[model samples]
Target: MALTGSLDAAAQAKAAKAEAYKAPRTAFGQPDLSGYWTNNTMTPMTRRPGVSSLVYTEDEVKKMEAEAEAEVEEGNAPTDPNAGAEAAKPAASSLRPEFAAAGGDVGGYNRGWLDPGHTVMRVRGEPRSSLITTPNGQIPPRKKGAPPPPGFGRGLGSFDSYETRSLGERCIIGFGRNGGPPMFPNGFYNNNYQFIQTPDHFVIEVEMNHDLRIVRLNAKHRTDDVRPYFGDSIGWWEGDTLVVETTHIPQSQGFMGSWKDLKVTERFTRVGPQRVHYAFTIDDPTVWDAPWGGEYEFAPLNGRIFEYACHEGNYALPGILAGARAEEQAAAEAAAAKAAEAAKSKAKDKKAGD
Candidate 1:
């Protein structure tokens, strides 16, 4: 009787522990969300053409990945001297439209440094066709009469003071939406981040430009009517997930051409030992007819985040890349001139024979 009672007591204790289980916690006793993470995957933000479904079969994903790899390898390979202009034409079908774009010598020869993700993005082992979860795997169409978002220097900024320049041009922030409420990869490089959690605040140190997103925990929204760069973010813990609602995004930094009334709700949850599932819902009644959102999984960054002190060096690289573009333009012009000369010669010969 004593032995049986002891075994029963042990079993009861195990059951109690299971019922009260909790996720890993920080030293301050909050669910730990502090670490370096990355969301680099081959999945585009919106579904690309030819992708028929939200979730792709393993075989389909493999074929697409293989094709992308092969195309890169071919692009980087040495060109054949005897090959004609036809060699310049893109393949009839491609992994996506961007892959077919002629990125000049810089993108072709310098691809080793680019980390645009090699494998498909998987959520719970299912390879997703895109990060967006809409039925069509795209952003919902804008409302019928939604006004276009205002741009500071889309075209006209030459004569004006330097103040009129775009945020990116001024180095206020880098492009490609790396430091976003719905933080996304730059798609070219530097897709890493360091997340820090404190009792009163949550800070995200973006690798690109060292952009910092400071979230006030359990705080009320500011009503100064002044728009901020990444917007005013306030977060609270809902169980183990950090739920954040952001508003007042600057017009230049709005997501999908929304700003005045844009609101983004983000949820970051620890899903496993090495992964954190990030999801977001975007709401702007004037922009879209309904609230829409997307999701992607984040894994621990392989390396640490280094300080990115950017300033003058940014222009040096763009200038070098521009040289590559100029080279391609000159070649195209020469080819066109040669074709025209050949046509004229043929015409003159025929006229003389007649």
Candidate 2:
């Protein structure tokens, strides 16, 4: 939130400092953190050991930035925020770990479909490799052989239908990983986000499905209500930072490996005119051994967030099902023709022998 709308720079600075020093409050004196923001970046959810820590060497930052810029310049950008299954670069496999699994040579979109920026964020003007601060810069692995999250219909009976797929495939949530607890950029272009702040809460609308995450500040967790698709979140202010802790995630909204017991802690701090510092910690003891966290700087954009309108426009599901039916019909017809031909050949042979 704007600092009291005072025009004086010195006064604003003083107020901001004071606000950061104290527990943050909302516009209604409750710990104000209501605004539009986004978290679409090349930064991974976890850190990479080669690029561990928020601090990056000048050479590494320059190299990484140059590569990303080259990608854009060469007209090889990403597609929609959650638009996976795209054609990756020729060297996609080599770049896999450095990039996410989304980096592939498989068929998909090009640079014309991407919106990821080239320049990495500077916390204090120094580039960071990942949002996470762990030594390895990676999320800890899930417990060995931990069962897949519930609601997964993988290997289900034939009659189970495709409803067992992820919320994204069903066009329920944002198409990509645009929404957050640890919001990371997808391979697509519209991974952009918008933030709306009100007197009591903050709403983050991801551009994909227009997935909305509402964080209620200075409030208690909703323990009695049904678990939400995006989990339950309660927010508070720690000085200038807006902190939100989320839990009670439904099985439908699994985060990578962890299932129902996952917890995410997020921090949003407006550190610059066009930028906010976004940090998050993920913990699920049943899934991981230790909590891991990361931070990324979000720069404000000029465009307005648009409605995703996925359900209305979706045609992929019907198309896939129809294609399958057509294939089955063709196969059955071919089998029947083959059987008839075989019987006719046998009758002809018998008549000739007689």
Q: What digit string (tens of lDDT, one per residue) describes model 2 on residues 145-164? A: 77654433332333234575
lDDT of 1 by residue, 201-260 (tens): 999988888889999999999999998889999999998889999998987787767888
Q: In angstroms, how far off is 259's CA in candidate 2?
A: 2.3
* TM-score of model 1 (CA atoms): 0.74
**Residue ranges of candidate 2 with Cα displaced over 4 Å:** 1-27, 30-32, 48-54, 76-107, 148-162, 309-314, 329-354
Model 2's lDDT to the true fold? 0.65
Task: Please report the candidate that would top lDDT against the real structure.
Answer: 1
The TM-score between candidate 2 and the true structure equals 0.72
Candidate 1: stretches off by over 4 Å: 1-22, 71-96, 99-102, 105-109, 149-161, 309-311, 314-354
TM-score, one value per model: 0.74, 0.72
